[model samples]
Target: MRNILLLICFALMSSFIQGQEILGDWYGSLQIQGTKLPLVFHIKKQDSSYSTTMDSPKQMAIGLPVAITTVENSQLLLEAPAMGIKYTGEYDHTQEIIAGTFQQGGLKLALNLSRDNFTTAINRPQEPKEPFPYHAEEVRFYNESDDISLAGTLTTPEGLEKFPVVILISGSGPQNRNEEIMGHKPFLLISDFLTRHGIAVLRYDDRGVGKSEGEYATATSKDLSRDTEAAITYLKSRKDLKISKLGLIGHSEGGIIAPMIASKSKDVDFIVLLAGAVLRGKDLLLLQKKLIEEKSGIHDSIVNRSQEVFHGAYELIASNTKTNDALKEDLAAYFKEETNNSINAAQTNSLIESMTSPWMQYFINYDPTTALKEVDIPILALFGKKDVQVPAIENALALEKLENKNIEIFQMENLNHLFQESETGMPNEYSEIEQTMSPKVLNLMLEWILERD
Candidate 1:
């Protein structure tokens, strides 16, 4: 999965004509899939050169530096080499707009910037507000293994002296305590729901995000598992609250993590997985790419071709036969030949860098079947039938193969990866939908946990 943050393109400093009309802020809405994302380019004049910064208001990210910018002959080009984002457009003086196409990797979308401010009215009604019915406290804990302090919020039902508590583990991306994304705070809502029902919840920022202290970019899933281990250690030390039962509630990548911890840790009493993967990492990613590409309306021919290219690349990486440098060189050559030189060097480099990252390398080889089999605790795994990211049908089949009596797996009909009732279940539709999470999902979790107690 991509980062929960909407915009990845970062600023450009280049020589341009003086006193150009594109000097101020230019607003645009990048429509990907069905969701509309607002983007702003703050162009400024600096002596003989021009500097540009980008703002993604929806994601709360601003003042992002652009890598390259050029304007000449009523045409403008903006490129962020690191992110593989490139925009080439012509400034229409009559319409007072810059008609452009935004390209990143294999995806391309129309993005038109205008002088008028473009804003997407964000409505997330399910987010809990204060005068909350529970007791919430800001807490700090240390991951002794990493020697770093992590910050989070712990919420418990009012007047509960002893209770079962679960640590809320986020997905693949760097997320805050709330798992804030696309104007939605699913973790905040989840904590509120569970706490109101008499279960304590602890949700924290990923390392290097929000108030946490540690580097996230380089940390693999195994490293993140240590952070959760610290939270478990912290909960056990709280003699005042007396947490009776300690369980884990993990979503997406967290699903993979929950099993990793439960298989070895005697401290974990139970675990819940939301949209978890049952297949091997490489297999899951390949399936994810194919499903998403087909749903996005790409022709079968194109999807098949793209899938073949990615499959080859993933195989090379998984082989581990060559040094990192040699592997990168091989990947570069392979990609160039596969695409017939259609992809630019910057895009190829960005793709190679991501596929070769520590996390990607680990994920490509990870198989959670052994971990899942070793877990003796009660396990609850839920999947959205409409989820294209982790398709329920395939995972459910895999679960059937396990036949673990302690595990209970359900495929919720018509739900998406986020457990929201969805039609298409594409990532583009995640921000457009109003529901933070389906009430049915919340109720199911509550009932299951309460029954266990």
Candidate 2:
């Protein structure tokens, strides 16, 4: 899931370039699995050099820095070393377009830039309107462990002196407080609905994302768990809210982190898992890749071959016996041999770096069952039948094996990972769907939480 976001955001940034003729804003769209992600590049000339920034309108990311920009002989180049992405495009002056290829982690995609000033807006009907019926406050809390302040929103039902509260933990990626993706703010919608129903909700930005402070690139899931613990502690200190019924509601990666906290802390009263993974990270990712690709209509043979390659890679990483440099060299050789040298050295290095990051290393080997088995509090695990990312049957069955009488698992039919009633249940359809969250699922969650005390 993290890799998917990295690819999408990197491809969007690929359209950004600094060229003499490419000043102002250049727009482009990267087509991924039937979804068109609209990207905009703001380019300006600074003395003899060029400066550029990227905007992913669909993803609601703006002013993303392009670390290196150069134009020579009509060839435009943009590089963001921090993200391990590079783009090279040839400016066609006659057509007023830049023909380019975006490359990251040995994957390459065609991304042509145009000066057409294309603007896109997704109509999210379920997104709460202003003048909300709840009391919303912008709040900040410090993560004492990481020495960083996290920014978030706290929403409470109007006229409620004290109320049950749940902290919203987002899925993977560097999400803001709203958990905005493809122009849909899931956390905001969830918070609004819960607050309206007399439940207080707190949703914060992930470390180093949005208004929060910390280094997201280097932080592992354990570090994120500490951040969540900080939120719980911060809430306990609030006199305006009741902490007696405080709990956690996490989506995907956040779902896993909730258990990690609950297993160790007595502060967590309950937990709701939304499309959480019950399998080990490597197993979950392999299945996720296969299912998502198969749903995207990729040939079985291709999907099988890709899975085989990744399986081998994952196995090597799981061993955890190799040093960083040694593992990088081994993986590079493996990828080179598997791809028949079609991938270049730079691409291989990029892939190695991403696969071996602190977070990825931890996630690939971590098993959520270790924490889930220890959680004795009431648990509500929900899954969308169409969620290819964490297939309903495999994960739900795994959760059931825990045999904890306090846990209840439900598989919502016709819904996707994001809980929207979906057709194909692909991530691409999340933004296109009119609903932010299925009312049935939301109601079920509210009922479960309310029933818990």
Candidate 3:
């Protein structure tokens, strides 16, 4: 569920004497693991200096400022200090192109930019248009425990005195209120459908993302549970929503967080888990790697060896006695040996850093069964048969072990993690799929919620 927007670079190099050549938009794509992430650089001349901003169309990130922009001798240097990104490229005047290498986080990749703006359009027909029938309002709420203000959208049916409400907990990432990814706004569409059917919905941005005010990188699952609790508190104060009917609808990691909150908080009456992970984080990730690799036609022997290396690394991290430095050194040695020294130091260090993050550490060690087993409220857990991230069979089986009469599990035939009707169910295909969410899943969820009461 964590959507990492890989940074793409576009260098606009031109002679200062003839700045007009680089004054417009330059387009390029960064090829990362078979995915072409489209990037657009909008450059403008301001007196003697130039200013530029970048847009990542695939990730829906726009107007990201370039901290330093310089052009001299038909060469360009664009640096974004915040993202640790730097691009240096030479301009070919006759070809109207810039050939460069984009470097960030110890990885260097080639990127070529052209004057012609070639945009890739993704069609998402389910995204709701403006002038929605329901009442949509921008709202803010406080998480007193963390002392941060979170912002989001609350959609309610018009003319309804009181209605059942559900707070939408986004998956693992710094998502906006819409849970937007690959140009699809699933949360907005879900809110629209639910609100239109007489259900009030609340969906907020991850802390430190969008309008929220908290540091995302430093927060853990426990910290996120507090934020969800705060959302419950905010809704309880509202007079137009039925407090007794309040529930939670969580996707991916959010699915895990919902049970964490509901196990203790009496406010949550029901919960809906969409593509939730029931297995421990380490097991879930290993299965995910195997499934995705197999689907990509990788050999079983290679996949098994890869899993073995990852398992060793995860085991080292799970041990509380190992210090961060020791863990990194051990993991690096293991990776080097497993890859026969083919993996470079920089890439190895990058992988180690990501694996050692606070979030990843907490996630790998945290087991959702402890929380799910304690949740006495009615629960509906849905999984997609083709979902590679959290395989439907394994997760659904894990949930079934809870044996809680209040819990109902369903594995859909052809849906993906995002609940979209998918082909291979790979993350790359999420953008290409025209459907935002399966209408059948939406109807099923709505019916389950309506029947709960």
> How do all the candidates rank in terms of TM-score, highest first?
2, 3, 1
Best by TM-score: 2
Stretches of candidate 3 exceeding 4 Å from the true structure? 3-26, 30-72, 77-88, 91-97, 101-110, 114-120
Q: Residue pairs in steric clash, candidate 1?
A: 10-65, 11-65, 11-66, 11-67, 12-66
| lDDT (10s digit) by residue, model 1, range 1-453 | 642212244434444643477789898888866767778888888877887777665444545567777777888887776667788998988888999999886778898999886434768889899899998999999999999999999998888778899999998867789987767899999999999999999999999888999998789999999999999999988888878789999999999999999999999999999988889888898898888778767899988997799889889999977788998999999999999998778767877887888899888889978799999999999999999878999998897799899999999999999898988988767777899899999999999998887
Query: How well does candidate 3 score on lDDT at residue 309?
Result: 85
**Candidate 1 vs candidate 2, TM-score winner:** 2
Among all windows of 10 consecutive residues in model 2, the one with the lowest summed lDDT is 5-14
lDDT of 2 by residue, 358-434 (tens): 88989899999999999999999999999988889999999999899988999999999889999998776765787
- Evaluated against the true structure, the overall lDDT of model 1 is 0.85
lDDT to native, each model? 0.85, 0.83, 0.82
Regarding TM-score, does 2 or 3 come out ahead? 2
Q: Which regions in candidate 2 have their CA more than 4 angstroms from the true location?
A: 4-25, 31-37, 42-67, 72-75, 79-119
Question: Candidate 3 — worst ten consecutive residues by lDDT sum?
Answer: 5-14
